[model samples]
Target: MLYKLNLEHILFLDIETVPQKPNFADLDENTQMMWEQKSQYQRKDEFTPEEFYERAGIWAEFGKIICISVGYFTSKGDSRNFRVTSFYGEELELLKQFKQLLQEHFNQTRHLLCAHNGKEFDFPYIARRMVINGMNLPYKLDLFGKKPWDVPHLDTMELWKFGDYKHFTSLKLLAHVLGIPSPKEDMDGSMVKGVFYEEDDLDRIVSYCELDVVTTAQVFLKLRNEELLSEEEIKKV
Candidate 1:
């Protein structure tokens, strides 16, 4: 089987983010200048890490979690499915639940935890949150200094170009190039903070995350030369 399909492991993942809250406070000269020179994309409600922190509901007090979506696929299958979970309320409690789920379903080395830009964002966010909540880092996450190519840590964005480390690719752009349908709806990452603060609806965030995971899985499938799924073969729930 290993020779036939080149299979190795399962994939787990998570995303940490906050809503883009309003910046009604006094804008610094630099910020004001930047806003004045905003591009069409820049005009959209996207927020920087600092902006997300200022107003995101979950991060407002204890930091926001927006959503965490996990995808699992085998080398033999064309379709990869992601089980996206959402967390609301206190950051510490949510972090605890997230840790429990990882421990319950995944064992480091047996399964890999995958993310798009997780090395910089998802994993570190989870680790910091765990420590803040008085919990220890998972063994898999604690394995620092190991090369990513040698370990289960797979970042599709990083792998898309085989670590040339230039020309970052957006998940949506990748899906388009591969003929995979984008899972993201009308809302982009920037609007997440608003959804949390203005809408207070966690389900929206969860659905958005599911879209990201599905897109990620689709990209992975394409890279492995597996058949892509038909619309009927994919199910959100």
Candidate 2:
């Protein structure tokens, strides 16, 4: 079934997010209370809400997307090129730009949005943040009433599960097991918050996000029994 799909129609992506505020104290009193309540189970006396705040990005209500990097394929005869690009800076603006890209170019029924753990994390995180920012959901991201099979999204982690709903696989583990190059050589998701809030290095995050996008595309190709992308075949634009 994977072989039947057109690779050109799929937009592979990854995102980086950080807490909405630089510090836990930056949130208003009511919001801070809400955060404590929301993260209670996860915190479980192991850490205070302020101490656990570094992981707030995992929850859309308390986080904002800082980067969204995408990659897609183009082929002509025997030659193929994978072009990568990113949208970053100012959460609302980046979301708008990403929405425009989906609505303008990838709006057709045949087009798809693919990410590593997108169905669980990336996809819903983007949708929730869009709503929080007062932006209408784009067609691809709006899945309110669509049937499961009708959705135009692909998840590498879900694909690897192969109906084992209990299975969970991280992108780094999947890439390593599948022999795709590691995207976490420089930094992993754990370091994103510090990079964004303390170091203010969005460029580094964007690069890491793009690497995940490229690695995701490579993983998809591997799933389809297709050739892995050579470094020369990947272009950043």
Candidate 3:
């Protein structure tokens, strides 16, 4: 099997999610139940998703997709540029626009969609939401059913499994270990809902998502020997 992906051919992406409401405490019983079940697995710290929703209220009222950010690395005359686009607002319309733009600008034969932890979260979330809105998925998304090695997918979280699944490493920790500065150290996924819904600061969410994709791209470069891995601790993980 060949393992060569043109850095230019890969578009890195990340997304932010929160509930559609203003407060989880204000959520109806059914919505609360839904959040509880989904949160059961997602919550690792002492706070369950329900508890976090009650405390933070971003996810409870914001309705999941606060922002979807995509970044592509472009090189021109020895200059490397990271170009980014962010989709935020009522999910249904923005999602359609995001997909349409991607399809118009990028095709499967040339560009491959990539993301961090995208297989489990970002990709599926986008696909399911697209289906919910009666939209067509991009061509490469259909490749998901094929063997992992055959697909264009490259998830850093899954890559971490090269060491062991026993220890969970976040994008921040991975970046730190690899000596890549995390542009998002000041905030994280947990704060996404609040920063977006409560503060009406969609840009922050977009920035956060963009940083995640950039970090994912950095991680991928290190993995592929396209870039240097600065920290020795990265090998341990």
Candidate 4:
């Protein structure tokens, strides 16, 4: 069990992304053509690439990360609290701040980045976006020639799969099944585009992203058969 891996060494995180542009029509000629080719494989005949562009956020090449929320555990006496912080706003500023946080605190080999499906989605997405932004890769996000055992990325969803690559589970579903509190009351990834573009509510999106980071941590504890964090034990930083 991962309980053997000290919780204090792990930084749990989640990110919110939206299409790089407000809409498909806003893409430059080269990007538009690239998107069209990419969407063809994922969308059906009834959906034009423009209509399907709403899903572009899931693809690192076509999306911009609007927020990245991270949480880590700190112990005080017999109590352990999870402190979460977030970076928001424009993509470059958001990436810079997040990178600074990693470089400052979680840069060491012993610190791990844990997310629900981090290795596949969150980790790679952040790495790809950082390169596109002309930034050097942070140690945790870089895997140029890393041996599998050397990587410090912990993926809760991948853990739950128990080597069953055939099945994929959502963090929400895992939380419910594990008897942890649900984090889905307000909105989900599908609604992120509208929240960011139409509503212009980065605050709302940040709140949602924070919930995912906390929930991912909770799920990890559940998998380890450890007590879930009480509400009072969660802090915002």
Candidate 5:
């Protein structure tokens, strides 16, 4: 079934997020209480809400997207290229730009949004943040009444699971196991919060996000038993 789909119809993407505030104290009293309640199970007695705040970006209610990097395939005769681009800075503005890209270019019954673990994390996170920012959901992100087969989204992690629902795979680990190049040469997801809040390095995060997008595309190609994308075939636009 994967071979039946055109690679050009898929938009591969990855996102980087950070907590809404630099510090736990930066949140209002009510929001802080909400955070404590929301994260209690995960925190247990090992860490306080403040200590667990760095991981708040994992949830849409307490976090904001810092960057969304996307890559799509293009073919010219026998040559194929993957062009990558990113939207970053000012959460609302970037979300608007990403929505515009989906609505204008990728709005079709066949177009798919592909990411690693996208259905569980990236897709819903983007949708929730768009609603929080007062923007209407784009068609691709809006999955209100669509049947499971009608929805056009692909998840590498889900694909890797096959029939095993209990299996969980991180993009980095999957890439390594699949023989795809690692996207975590500089930093991993655990370091994203410090990079954003303390070092103020949006460019670094964008680069990492783009690499993940590229790696995701490569992983998809591998899953389909197709030729892996050479480094020269990837272009940052």
Candidate 6:
């Protein structure tokens, strides 16, 4: 089914997020208590709220998107290329920048967002963050009454599922099995919180995020039995 679609119409993307505060203690008393209740089932008795706070980024309520990398395909005659770009810095500012890109360029019925596990994580997380930050919902990100078929969103992980509905596949593992290079050389999700707080190196995170976008696009191409983009073909815009 993916092979039948025009690749140029899809926007490949990936995002990185972290807890708003470095640690649970940095939050106010009420927020701390709220987190405890929210995370009780996930944390159980093995870890306290403070210790479980490290996993806060998984929840949009406790997290903020630090970086969003987006990519789209362009064609010149028979040759096709993919361009990747990123917005990273202050959370709200970066979100605004990304939203601007969407509104100015990729906002159209033919344009669809493609990401790994985007429907479950990336898409909703971005929408929730936008609302939380007092931003308007973009056409593609908004999910009012639009039926499942109407949503202009595509996910590589969901595609890979093939209706299994019982197993999970990591992006790195998919890339490996599909013969695409792994995007885990820099820092995996577990290490992102520490790197963002302790290392103060958003650049590293940005690079990692962009690789994910590129890898995700490659994964989609592979699924459709299409040619993968060469290194020289992927320009950073």
lDDT string, candidate 5, 15-85, tens digits: 99999999999999999999999999999999999999989999999999999999999999999999999
lDDT of 3: 0.69
Better of 2 and 4 by lDDT: 2
Q: What is the C-alpha lDDT of each candidate?
A: 0.61, 0.94, 0.69, 0.92, 0.95, 0.91
Q: Which candidate is the best by lDDT?
A: 5
Q: Give per-residue CA lDDT, model 6, range 109-164, as digits (tens).
A: 98899999999999999999999999998888988999999999999999999998
lDDT of 4: 0.92
Q: What's the best-to-worst order under lDDT? A: 5, 2, 4, 6, 3, 1
> 38-138 in candidate 4: lDDT tens per residue?
88978968699999999999999999899999999999799899999999998899899999989999888889999998999999999999999999999
Q: Where does candidate 1 clash, by residue pair?
A: 19-192, 19-193, 20-193, 58-63, 59-63, 59-64
Candidate 2, poorest ten consecutive residues by summed lDDT: 179-188
**TM-score: which is higher, 5 or 6?**
5
Candidate 3 Cα errors over 4 Å, as ranges: 1-3, 36-63, 143-147, 163-167, 228-237
Better of 1 and 2 by TM-score: 2
Per-residue lDDT of candidate 2, residues 1-237 (tens digit): 789999999999999999999999999999999999999999999999999999999999999999999999999999999999999999999999999999999999999999998999999999999999999999999998999999999999999999999999988888899988774468889999999889989999999999889989989999998999999999999
Candidate 1 has its poorest 10 consecutive residues by lDDT at 1-10
Write out the backbone clash pairs for model 4.
Answer: none
> In candidate 4, residue 231 scores what lDDT?
91
Model 1 gets an lDDT of 0.61
Would you estimate the TM-scores of all the predictions?
0.71, 0.98, 0.78, 0.97, 0.98, 0.97
RMSD of each: 6.6, 0.9, 6.1, 1.1, 0.8, 1.1
- Per-candidate clashes come to 6, 0, 10, 0, 0, 0
Over all chains combined, what TM-score does candidate 1 have? Answer: 0.71
Name the lDDT value of residue 51 in candidate 3: 67
